[model samples]
Target: MSLWVDKYRPRSLDQLSFHPSITQNLKALASTGDFPHLLVYGPTGSGKKTRIYATLHELFGPSVEKLKIDVKTFTTSSNRKLEFNVLSSPYHLEITPSDMGNNDRVVIQDLLKDVASTEQVDFTNGAGNGSGGHGGPTRHRFKVVIINEADSLSRDAQAALRRTMEKYSSNIRLIMISNTTSNIIPPIKSRTLLVRIPAPSSAEVASVLAHISKKESVKFTDSNTEPFFEAVANNCECNLRKSLLCFETIAMQTAQINVSNDSTSIIKLDWEVIIENLAKSIAGNRTVANLAKARVVFYELLSHCIPPRVILKKLLFCLISEVKPSMATELVSIAATFDERLSLGQKSIFHLEGFTAKVMVALEK
Candidate 1:
């Protein structure tokens, strides 16, 4: 079965739940037939992409949803070749050039030129008739290029984008989606209209959860359901996508359990539980043997695709609750050090293990 997040996602601007003001503004803009380049950004799971797709559907109709994936190869100025997979429809193209890392500039410039150079086919007139009194020429005025995770784009690539945005303004509209606009250069920011989508509030998230449960015929009347969803929403940190997934996971796990007892255990993601346990183990024990064991758990989390930074942050929070006030200050300092180091180097495991070792040493002294 399809995930509830996708299954219940709003297909149009009017269907959006939170940020009604933003949706209304978008609806008004969509009706105008012509609008400036858009920069839609927000925290994860906050519906930036959903709104982008909805806007596209509003602008180009259902044809925009008939997308196909294409893998294209481009050669960099340094003589290196890079291949990127892009999702494209008749009206627009979507790509995450950040996947190419520093070479993203090459991909951005080449791809933009390739798409903008080609004039849109005018099919407004009846086919085979060059000119007609009844049917003239209808043409797509412009195409959209949506770049996702744009904040991950290197500074150099973003600079290249600024020029391309100006050069292709007539034929292409660029919609950049990112977690924040801070990383976006001023020139590009000046060129596009910015739209920020905030994460849903706890009540809004709970309401959406309720709607999903009712639609799926899940038993919401169970005593465990209310607190369970509230806990999920809070634990998800206002991330609607994570909240929904957590809800589904817990529902499946406790499908057969008695409702009264189920409320006693607030469901946490398996990785979260693992991180919590790891934190307790480190705080409680300070020895080489325990450190070694902790490393194993860290690797296990990494294997599950839990980012090293996320693991470190969760570990820090868990440690804060378990340690003394003075120890908490020391631990935060150590975490910040490692976090900075982690960003400067590619050896995430080394930094992660080093942080654990430091914590152990601190506790021992």
Candidate 2:
């Protein structure tokens, strides 16, 4: 069975329920034969990718949905083989250069060059030439190259991309998705049309949850189901993806006879629960034993592929509520120090454990 996130996802600009103003603007951009490169920035679960796809649908129709995965390999200067999967259709291609590590510059430059060298063709019905030959009446003059996690791209890759963006403006349009734009350099930022999609409000999230709940036949044991949805919306911190997953988990759990509709029964993501427990432990006590336990948990979370920065951020969020109001500022400053370290330094475990130890000390005061 498909996940609810995918099953109920808005397929086109018109289908998007929230952010009507942004939807209207995107539709305006898509109405034309050409538009500038788009730098789409938003928080997680804020529907950045969904909006990008919807815009693509407006430009190329359902043909963009017929995607195939292609794995391309590039040989580095050290003769190392780097391979990553590319999602592509006749009209567009998507890639995450962050996956290529330090070699991202090579991938970005070479890949964009190759894609831009060829002119785009429209094979959809009357959009293409009658002979089905190279000479075709193009529905759109450019192919889209979607760069996911554009903020995580290396400086070298971004530098190379700035030049390539101008050179290939004719044959390609870039749609870059990122959580924030602080990491993106000014040159590339200047070249693209920036679109910011904020997280939906609690009411928006609750409304969506209510619709999905009705469609899925989720039954609330209590007479007043409003609180259930509102509680869920708040608990998820306005993240639509987490709200859906949490709601689905509760629905499944409540199906087994005699389930309570209280907020305490809400099922949080496993990693979140782990971090919450760790925060409580640190807040209550500061000892070698507690620190040792935290180190083990840190390794466990890292092994499970949870990013160190996310671990630190969630830890702070949980820790802030446990400590006195005066401590929140100090805690945030400490987290900021380690957050930069996590970005610059190689060993994330050191920063993660360091931040926890620091928090434990502050709580001890």
Candidate 3:
């Protein structure tokens, strides 16, 4: 069986549950035949990808949903082979920084240039087949290039992307997805229409949980399901994807959700628990031995593919509670410095370790 997150995901703009205004705007843009490049950014699990796909579906009909994964290889200046997966359909393609590595500028430019040189022609309909008298083909004039984790893109790659956007404006539309625009350069930001999608409120998240529960036929023993779902929604911090997975975990264990008895423990993701333990270690004492131990844990988290910025952010949230408000303010500044360094430097461990040591020193002072 497919995961509930995927099974219940909204496929079209009309079916989207939250952000009615954004939905309406996307609909109007799709109706305009084509639009300028878009930078759709928001927090994690905020349905940014969902809205982008829905907009694509609206523009290209069902053909946009016929997705396929293709692995493309490029040769680097050092003659090394860099292979990356490209998810695409007839109308759009999706790529990420992980796919291009340090050679994103070259790979992205070549890929987009190839796509821009071709005109999209739909053969399924006579009107789109250029068969009609004097009107030419009625197919969509452009294809979309979706850049996921655009914030993680290096400065050189983003510069190359800016130039590509200007050169291929006629036949290619770029949609960049990022958690934040703090790292995005100004030139690209100016070229695209910025769409910021905020995270759903707790009440909105609870309603979605309730909808999923009813559809799944899961009955709560509690007289009112509000507290049960509200608890889940709050526990997941209003992250819809995380909320669904949390609810499904509970449903699998027992259909009867009891809010009063404290029997249902919200399952914390393993990485979260690890970070919590790391915070406790820091809180226990600020010392060389502890810092050494913390380094090992940091390496473990990074090895598991957790982004350093995310680790640092969560680590700050955990550490803030253990210190005074004034110290917490100081800690935020330290984290902010390391965060910028994490984005600019190649070695994440250096920045992460540096942040930890600085926190230890600050706590001591």
Candidate 4:
């Protein structure tokens, strides 16, 4: 159950909540037989990749079929004899997303360069020459390549990619995922279908959480589930991952215990503690002392993969709840500004510091 990342991913498009319009848009493209390259932009863990891959699977079935039928149809090859090509020949191409600097367009282009150079053969159906032989008519397929964090793509790298996208638009459908459409280059942006994925609505997010709780055999009351879900959603800024993690944390710490007292803190982390801790981290306090404390708290909050934007806003909500009404509006404004930078992939420690200072100063007065 600890491996909930894989365990709980929405297996079907219907399993994804509150983004029906976006899913419908993708569904339309998938069914159309003319899937222009797509940029599925949204905050992290908001189901961009899941939704696209779900559409791919719904259209093509499995990974094998996706690589073969869709990609193997690109037969514009110049081989003399024949080449046998496996769907994932050399079979190791994968896109791993992380905050590391290794994520750039050069690496993406290099990977494409390797894929484009490979040959496909149909020796089984026709007479073929030796290993270096390029003989009969061969069939090749277009490939689907995804850049998980497209917002992280460097400016120069994106420029390089614009040329590659134009060059291979026929043979490849490039899928770029980001938190916002603005981060992408206008030309690259122009070429692809844009699926704007929104955060899950409160009702939609709760329905799924309720289903999960029931599956786990945890008996959360109907009344309590909504409040908890709503609270976490607001805290995690409507990020699906964080909302799920809130349930998981309580479930784990309590031995997956079914508790009617969902009001009690399983991790002993009340909203007040959360506010103060967020303030500390936001106040330029990423020190060993702060981080050591933060890791346990952060992980507890993050296991569900909630978007960072959600968490920051929730922290603001907590601050607002604790602060005077006269200053609540100002703090809320600060939270929004902070989240905007975060979604753009700007490190928020500095912005957070300013936000926390304002909150703390406001609190002090």
TM-score for each predicted model, relative to the true structure: 0.81, 0.90, 0.94, 0.62
Model 1 residue 64 CA deviation (Å) reads 1.5
Candidate with the greatest TM-score versus the true structure: 3
TM-score of candidate 3 versus the correct structure, residues matched by position: 0.94
Candidate 3 residues lying further than 4 Å off, grouped into runs, are 123-139, 262-265
Among residues 3 or more apart in sequence or in different chains, the pairs in candidate 1 whose N, CA or C atoms overlap within 3 Å are 124-138
Residue 262 CA error for candidate 2 (Å)? 2.0
lDDT of 1 by residue, 1-365 (tens): 88888899988777888888998888777765557899998988898999989887776667788899999999988788778999999889999987776788888989998998776665653233211122224335678899998876777888989988878778888999988786687888888899999999988998898788878777643644666666668878889998888777766765543446545335567898888888888889888898889889988988987878789999999988888788988999999999777644556789999999998888877
Clashing pairs in 2: none
Indicate the residue-level lDDT of 51 in model 4.
84
> Which whole-number lDDT from 0 to 100 does residue 6 have in model 4?
57
The total of clashing pairs for model 2 equals 0
**Tens-digit lDDT string for candidate 4 (113-136):** 556445433343322321212223
* Cα lDDT tens digits for candidate 2, 1-365: 98898899988888888999999899878765568999999999999999999988877778788999999888888988888899999789999998776688889988889998888765453353211122225546688999999988888999999988999888999999999998899999999999999999988988898899889977666656666777787888889998988788777765631234365446667899999999999988799899999999999999999988799999999999889899999999999999877766667899998998888877777
Task: Give the true-structure RMSD of model 2.
Answer: 3.6
Error of 4 at 292 (Å): 17
State the weakest 10-residue window (summed lDDT) of model 4: 68-77
